[model samples]
Target: MENKQINIGIIGCGRIAQTRHIPEYASNKNANILGYFDFNKQRAEEIAKKYGGKVYESVEAMLADNDIDAVSVCVTNSAHASISIQALNAGKNVLCEKPMATSLEDSEAMVWAAKKNHKLLMIDQNQRFAKTHIRAKELLEKNTIGKALTFKSTFGHGGPETWSVDGGPNTWFFDKNKSKYGAIFDLGVHKIDLVQYLLNSAVNNVSARLTTLDKKDSTGKLIGVDDNAISIYELDNGVIGTVTSSWTYYGEEDNSTIVYGSEGIMKIYDDPTYSIVVIKKNGEKILYDIDQIQTNDNQTKSGVMDEFIDSLIEKRVPKSDAESVINSMRAVFASIESNETGKRVSISGTK
Candidate 1:
């Protein structure tokens, strides 16, 4: 298998599949897309025609194809677990999209299926692969900044309407049945996973406020899911931080994370001139002009696809595997519980 290219199948032909998964897999030398499936057959046909793959009549057909060594579960949030599980059970590795699943139980089930089938289950937590974030993690690991105390991480944009395949107010993102969550799951999950990865700590407590601020359906009614979320997290290591996910920022996107340590503060994607900045207690400042963080408008090769392919060929677990990302998914659910109960939720033993 090391010398053979992994045959890939995409389960959804939505915006994410077309823009990120398909192109990334096509660029990887160890992978080749073999099939495509979507609820909209025409959409699947179009993607297959453009990307050099066969269109499947149904997801079951795609999963049954013995030629496909793995499948990228790029469907809606609610279907992620079921489809991934099916692929795993069918003897194919799975690379699931973010938010893994709508619930912890479903996520665990996906992991269980992968383990039972002895297949790889990787999640697309792309933020951790960004050059800026990789550098920040290295700096933190090296103690470039002393003990990290508190931090703020934010991911905001106009809305998913500008990014989804449908490209309107009626995209599945606003529908709770399809998305299961809005800004929190769509955007917050990425930061939550990245924070945990960088700090080497799991979030143990969460308090949050989720609201529907501006987005509405074509009928002018408020969307069923939250448009904005502000969550405060306390990690197992006693580091505290705030995460804000919003789809209402009308200006330029604000995707930044800043950590304050005893010796200095580390800022990522915050400064206009630098990709990362560190300020010491003695007033010494350091600036790093690394590559810019990838955005929706300026898409870059998310190291995710390459890593997934390499992991399969090397017969090793990927960095963002399902088990590793489960805690981050737990934090997202915990934040929702805090919002509904109007109290801080503890995720210490929920794992």
Candidate 2:
């Protein structure tokens, strides 16, 4: 199996798959894209032309193909669980996009399906593979920052209206029924997951305020979803942090995270001038210049798919497995609950 190429069947041909997942997987020599599966045949065909694979008319067609070894489920948040469950039941390894499912129950089911079917289930929390993030985690283990004390992070952008495939308000990202939440769910999940990964802590409690303060459709009516949210979380390791996520930044994307520690401070993706910079308590500063994390807008190898394929070959769990990342998802949902109830909520049960 090491010498033989792994065939991949993709479940979505939209912006994410075409721009990031498909391209990254295509460039991997150990993998072969068997086909792309999308409800829209024309859209699938368009991607197939550029990515060198057939257009699958339906998901069943892709799953039935004996040549396909794994599937990448990149559909909307609502569809992630069902599609991934089907793929796992069909005996295919799954690489799902982040916020694995819209709810914790669905997330757990995806994990259970993978375990029950004996297939790999990895969530695409790609920030873990980001160069600076990995470096931060390594330094933290080495106690460079001397025990992360508190964190303040923000992830905001103009909006997803201009970020999706067609770039409009009608994208599933803005639909509450489809997406479940707005900025917090769409953009916040990544950062929340990053906090957990970098600091090696679990968010045990949350108090939040999620609102659709400024989002409206063409007719200027409330969208019934949160466009912005501010949350305070208590990690199991006694680290308290604030997370602000919004679709209303109205500027260049802001994906900044600052971790304050006993000895020094570590900032990731925050500085406009540098990728990473650390300032010690005694006024000594050190800057670690590094490349920005890859995204759909930026066409580069995200290193996620490459590592996922390597995990399959090595028969080991991927860096971002479903079971482990569920804690991050729990924190996200807990934030929503706290926002609704105006009280702190506890999220228990995490590995």
Candidate 3:
């Protein structure tokens, strides 16, 4: 069906759904947002009224509608797998927000459910689609900087308070029960996925330190999860790197990656004028003028929602498919374990 349009239902009417998923999907010619469901009925109704979709009182009600061929699971970190699995079992493709699930087991289950139901399962690891990152990946593939030796990738911001729909210290992001882990999952996962994608390798070992530095709840106590995290990773290809995530960056957001290679170094988003810069050992410098990476404040076409729609229409796996992202999730889990156990944690399998 070359002219087919995929019907979509959004599972949660949170900030991400409203800001990213809804707008992007609405812009895709082959995707239609037909329904919306949220824990708060009024919120769902509000979104439906503004976005031209039916409001379903419950997730089950939304999934039961056969007209919705796909659903975006934009809920809490803990609920991602369960809701996405439910949608998959109901014969709907799923586009789940990043940090796919709270646990590796849950992530695996979501992948399995999609395979069993023969539905597409795309993870919203939008970093892969960043124009700068895409160019960096191509350069790496071409050995533009020679074999990568080491790297550092970081994603930090003031906090999720201003970004979440309910802006406050007590936002669900700081709640361990709802978010499981804080910055490591919220910001770190994106870097982990991006580094792996850029290097075309899997992280096989991780050592981390996670700490709660500044965030406090309404009761004036530290939040239940870590606000800052730093991890050392060793990729299976013998490349070493450091990944850092934090909510304590009180100034401008810092989402940059620098890779040191045998020939020279490649910097992404580290320079104000150039999206990517390469300096060779021979003192030759190459610059690429690409679009800035998407941030919470400056929203852009993430290319995730569009990719999900195209995957459904083309009958192919998405660029950020469920199975492909498991390795990145594995690295995040390893980092957590390393922090808890005070030792280096090795990823269980080779990617």
Compose the digit string of candidate 2's lDDT tens values, residues 9-90: 9998887887778988988999899999887788888888877889877898899898899999988888999999999999
Candidate 1 least-lDDT 10 residues: 342-351
Question: What stretches of model 2 exceed 4 Å from their correct place?
Answer: none
lDDT tens string, model 3, 13-87?
889998899999988888889989888889989888898989887899988897988999998898999999999
- Give all candidates' CA lDDT scores: 0.93, 0.86, 0.92
Distance from true location, Cα of 173 in model 1, Å? 0.2
Please list all clashing residue pairs in model 1, or write none if there are none.
none
Error of 2 at 235 (Å): 1.0
How much is the lDDT of residue 324 in candidate 2? 86
Worst 10 residues of 2 by lDDT: 293-302
Candidate 3: lDDT of 40? 84
lDDT of 1: 0.93
Distance (Å) between predicted and true CA of 295, model 1? Answer: 0.9
In model 3, which range of ten residues has the least summed lDDT? 1-10
